[model samples]
Target chain A: MNGDAYWLGVASGFVVVGVVIEMVRRRYLRGRFALVWILLGVGAILLALFPRLLERAATALGVTVPLNLLLFLGSIAMLIMIMQLSAEAGRLRERTRVLAEEVALLRTLVGSADEPRARSIAAEDRDQDSPR
Target chain B: MGTRGRGKVLVVVPAYNEAEAIAGVVASVTRAVPTADILVVDDGSCDATSAVARAAGARVATLPFNLGVGGAMRTGFRHAKREGYSAVVQVDGDGQHDPAFIPQLLAALEHHDVAVGARFAGTGDYVVRGPRRWAMRGLASGMSALMTTRLDDATSGFRACGPRAISVYAQHYPAEYLGDTLETLVIARKSGLTVTQVPVAMRHRNTGRPSHGSARSSVELLRAGCVVMLGLVREWPVIADSSP
Candidate 1:
């Protein structure tokens, strides 16, 4: 947009890259997931350094407004990242449910062993279970 | 696996905050299926559900936190699998499902691997109206088409599972809302388990009111529809005849 704006964009891009690197160094963000943000930060720095590149690319794609193209691409990137997060959450939920089930079942086995009737029933079950 | 002939049965009652009704439910189930073992899974209730179920002379498996009916039922199925039970019949801890109908359910297992206790199969006076009824009808029709057999009440919680059904459920039961009823049926049908429906009347709850209402029913049904759709397209495990 202007010289001051270009410098601001470049500085902000560097800030983003520095924060991501720091998070990765502190083990707060995984390297695999941080790679996307690192690339985005580098792309922002390059675009700020050469503003004509974005306008040219937008024009080649038949977009009259370069900023609109940037916004559109940004939205798609956000949606993709959000979808990945949701999928990861679903996997974690499934694993947690399975762990809860296993813990409950294990507790039952140990709890039943303390009672006499359950002991006899469990023994009978073990005897009958050999065929399977 | 065809019948209850020489096969041990386990009644899995999944309870969440049903301390007031768990005892009576356990007692009735025991009276109805005296020969069968009873396992009441307390789904992390804040009340005395686990203690009450344990006091009722039924074995209790207590989850560390709430996992809904599907999770508790899966826990029960895993226990049955490990303990060598040949069949499992699920009775709701709310006392809505009549335990006396359990024999009829087990009898249906003679030909099918899974038997559902249908409320609208021309026997029960249970009625539903408005959006809830429409949603249930849509699900029933969709499931009927998928299973290639009539399923009058696809959302019925009362059900019986043979050895094959037990094995399939122990591995892939969904913990999502309505997954215990609708998704489990889809999984069973997808896994090659023959499913049948038996007419049974539901009783009124002994303690609390039903969970959802007219306003929430529609939203929950929409989510449930997505669950059934996922169940349809999801890759299911093959269920081999495990009973020799």
Candidate 2:
């Protein structure tokens, strides 16, 4: 109903999204992220009902719209994702180099197996024992 | 091309059913450099490969069974090392690689660790063919670029090895692997030994098409690719000199 209350609901939404993203990235706040999301969703509903908390929080925080808060939180989450992905890519590259070397070594083994060395002693005996 | 020089250089020819061309190949090498002793690794050929090579003045080391190209070459390299040759050049028995060019490779070996014959290097190529052949040559060019070393004929079995390479190659050559020849280069580099290729012309195979098998198991091509890539990752060559 009131602009203040509507903006308050938006602020709640921002804090919740930010916390959720942070928790997911860190992999530490599994239950807390869920709890926060629910609490913010409920707060959003309450703001719609009361229509006054928005005015209070907006005036308190000196912010204008509720949407900006949500955008800011998502941006932080994205930064975290990018950092993690880069690390993963680096690990995969190291693994690829390792596999390439292995393939090279195996190929070498197959090529050398044919080189003549020695025969079994029993075969030598067989040749010696044979009648001329 | 193992240039840790002292004794005479020995050239190893691994021939299978190459009876027809053995004499010519041997004659060329002997004529070019009379003192260079040649050994032929006759890989259980039913044909007269050994006799012809022997007739041409090459001592034959017969393998009771056919041990493929890598095996034949390794045996020859081993014999060279055991007999105490100053260096060894692995020449094919089929007459594809030139014996006349042996001196050129030897010349390169004076400064470089290895001398490789490039089939497409300059103005030659009477016989290396097919889409697969072109593809292999292209891959080698790219691999050389990647390794930061210019290797035009990275897959050539036509090579000259010195004492350093012989000592390492004699131990483990992956003789069963078709592409083990290329891997030896990678191994040499990894072991911190210098392996540089010299430009030499490659001619056509005098006899027999050494089967590509299937497009799937194109042994020669696959091993070529594998060796170059492995060079980057391996800590060093499988040189026994590294161990404590």
Candidate 3:
């Protein structure tokens, strides 16, 4: 890569690393997700700083083109991230369903205990709603 | 709160938008099992199912959103566990299940932890056809082998669960389609609870339509296969190891 392109890659990598760290610090992003992204950003910086390392990795992986190697690794990383997100979403949905069920059961318990009081309050509300 | 003559058994009716027939269902269940406390679990119905069931003299638990029958039954089972009930009988809210057979189901529970009201056990004229029938037979045979007993209708909604089955279901009932019936039986068997079946007569639904259409019956078969496979492969909690 040319000097300007190399600097651009390194700068973008630093930006990505900084933004993710800030997000984690502000509690906007969970540490588990942030860890993957931070590592990705650091890898990008390393590859940009030492282009020879990328060439060697591409050769070791039996890829003739270094850019193709980068693209393949990036694709795999995205796929893994997406799968992790799907798994997290499923867990969240299950948790939400459990919470909703618990709420329904609790409401039933409270409603039964407060039935008489609730009836009188309902009666008062109906009385207030009626035209004078 | 009114446990006047309420026995240890609770009848849990999982209802979803069955306002038209809920009152009648509740009434019939009450008439059949006067000593058993009736609980209507309103599965986020858009209609007045909860009010109708309450008016018909059954305690109602209204979910905030629809979580299907599995979620509703789990709520019922958990409530039964918390309230110290010894057993739970599931009666469908659509009035298809005859509450008169509830006594027979409960009686079966005397010898087993789970008693299923089997439709094809030669009592009911309830006939299923085509792919749905074949799928049900496949499930029944599979469950029979697993439980080491004959279960004519493994997907029967009408069932009575003793304390052990109640505990197992309260914690691990799957909210997926067919899970409330098929997977629940699998869970019961996996938990080392003995299961048995009693012949019961089923009636036509007073309201609402049947869940499976001819076109969808094939899809339902595929879904049932997935559910059974998942239930068998998934790790389950052993009742023997769990804290009492």
Alpha carbon lDDT of residue B122, candidate 1?
Answer: 91
- Candidate 3 backbone collisions, by pair: none
lDDT string for model 3 (A1-132, tens) is 788999999999899999999999999988689888889999999988988998998999899999999999899999999999999999998898898789778777787667446445434543564343
Q: Which candidate tops TM-score? A: 3
Which has the greatest DockQ? 3
- What number of clashing residue pairs does each candidate have, in the order they appear? 0, 27, 0
Query: How far off is residue B109 in model 3, in Å?
Result: 0.4
Model 3 complex DockQ against the native: 0.39
Which stretch of 10 consecutive residues in model 3 chain B shows the poorest summed lDDT?
Answer: B1-10
Query: Which regions in candidate 3 have their CA more than 4 angstroms from the true location?
Result: A112-132, B1-7, B240-244
Off by over 4 Å in 1: A112-132, B1-7, B127-142, B214-225, B241-244
DockQ of each: 0.34, 0.01, 0.39
Candidates ranked by DockQ: 3, 1, 2
Residue range B2-58, candidate 2, lDDT tens digits: 333247798888787788988888988888778898877776566777667766877
Q: Is candidate 2 or candidate 3 better by TM-score?
A: 3
Candidate 1, which CAPRI tier?
acceptable
Residues A1-132 of candidate 2: C-alpha lDDT, one tens digit per residue: 567866776677666667766776787756644565556556655655565565566657776875555466557866766786688787775454333333322332344343232223223533564343
